[model samples]
Target: MNRTPPSARTGNRRIRWPVVAGLSVVTAVITAVLGHQVPKSPSTSPTSAVPPQAPRGQHRDVPGEADGVVPDGVTVFDDAIPAVANLDPGLLKALRQAAKAAVNDGIEFGVNGGWRSAAYQNQLLRQAVATYGSEEEAARWVATAETSRHVSGDAVDIGRSDATAWLSEHGAGYGLCRIYRNEPWHYELRTDAIDHGCPRMYADPTQDPRMQQ
Candidate 1:
């Protein structure tokens, strides 16, 4: 048509499409420049997964070196204390030798308890709770982590309760020591005094006050 519509004739002119296109190009260029200036993630390098070897002249801690021996067995408890007769091979040898020495001295140092699994410890805790009403109450009568030497397979309870005193005096000479002060029945071979290919069995020896004796 030669004449414009009434709506278009009276209204102000609209922005041209070319201007909008130009503005879009400008916005895209600005965004690209800003993005280029942004930081990038650090690059990763290939690494070997193998463990490093220990340095030369370094010796690992082993049991029984204080008395010039190695552990002959380790304890693992499957059931009640009396039922625990078996021991770790290394621990068994040491026990046999110590027991022989004790027998010659007219003392009986029988194995009262040995190795124990987490399940066994849990059962013991449950039984204690049942009898004492609460874990805290049971702990007072029983040994807790600070007093537990059972976590290490080397610890054991020997003979009747009275034997604890004798063991305390003579056990270390045989490469054994009462580790926890609170647990009179707990004992472990002197691991720090020995040379093994591993670090000391105990991270903190002082945690067990009996070790000092």
Candidate 2:
């Protein structure tokens, strides 16, 4: 009655260690491979806030230092840079005169932004869109390529609080007037402003009629 069953024999039981270990390795390898994603190429899509109103290729991606990136310590008098040299002739003359006068007050007129190529202006609009979350909000800061005055060499953005402060006080004398109430750094030439004083400020680029273009 006490006979041991044949199924209870030690050698009769199948060992699953090898099969379980192999399956675990295969599962791990598959998981590792699936977890990673291949990277995609960068895109050059136009801004949704204000689409490219300019003709195609009008603002091609031009490569060079003159692509609207102002160097540190760059000033209104830095003609070596295309950004400074390519400004509207009358605007440049007015800026140089203003810079000369500002020096007497120990305020060097630094050029933060000026004479942007259309490509560069579009780059700025995209960057603004990224930072502000919405293209509409970005439009309030940066104008579209077709409407931007910087592309036309008609606008200059001054740097440093002190420089802008001095310009705010005396900029009208040289026909350099701040155009945007929100952007104290932005100024444009208004030749008549020399005698009649600067005109009323728009709240932002969005408020300017030209930006609607």
Candidate 3:
């Protein structure tokens, strides 16, 4: 006689469905919790918002409007070496006014070294270094771009050394002021302008890389 095997006969046996149902419910709860905790997208915050547009008429057709504007009396020195400087348009207007005022007061005012190339500045720096030795030593005698006011094009080396004292007394009326601590010669049209001196490197403004050097 052949005996019936229990394993072979267990094909239709029930799988405890309650245990499987409980596991499914637990998995659903875990998924819901994780979904709530984690952000769906990586870039969703107020701080990551896009920038706003610039106001109308604020942008000018100038090279360094981001830097500053050229004052009224000041003009670009378009020589073989280009000198593009920005002044306070108001200050420049004031310079003309001041020049008129100075004329009334018998003081002669003139502007020199408004905007300079980094090469010209470097040449001056080299001369200073040659005379003094070491940049630190030269800085005591001459201004670096970081300390030079000429980079902004707002600052100018006035005609006379005593111009600072005269400007200090009268510049605010024209929106101009001396920006440097040591360089009595340097003056800027804007009162709020930063006082960093001449840039270390000056690029030729006329050269266009697209035109083939």
lDDT tens digits, residue span 1-213, model 1: 598887785553454566778899999999999999997754753464456898976973332222112233322322223224334445556556676776666766655456555445555667788998987666643444334444345567664555667666666665666654555766667644343322223323443354343
Given candidate 2, what's the lDDT at residue 121?
87
Task: Compose the digit string of candidate 2's lDDT tens values, residues 1-213.
Answer: 797777666534445667778899999999788777555544754553556477877765654666877889999888899889999999999989998998999999888899888888888888899999999999999998899999999999998889899989999999999999999999999999999999999999899999997
Q: What is the C-alpha lDDT profile of model 3 across 51-170, one tens digit per residue?
A: 799888896433332332233443323222233324435545656666666666666565555665444555567788898778666665445554454554455666564555676677
| Model 3 misplaced regions, further than 4 Å | 1-91, 145-147, 192-213
lDDT of each: 0.54, 0.89, 0.54
Query: What would the TM-scores of all predictions be?
Result: 0.44, 0.70, 0.45
Top-TM-score candidate index: 2
Q: Give the Cα error of residue 161 in candidate 2, in Å.
A: 1.2
True-vs-predicted CA distance for residue 34, candidate 3, Å:
99
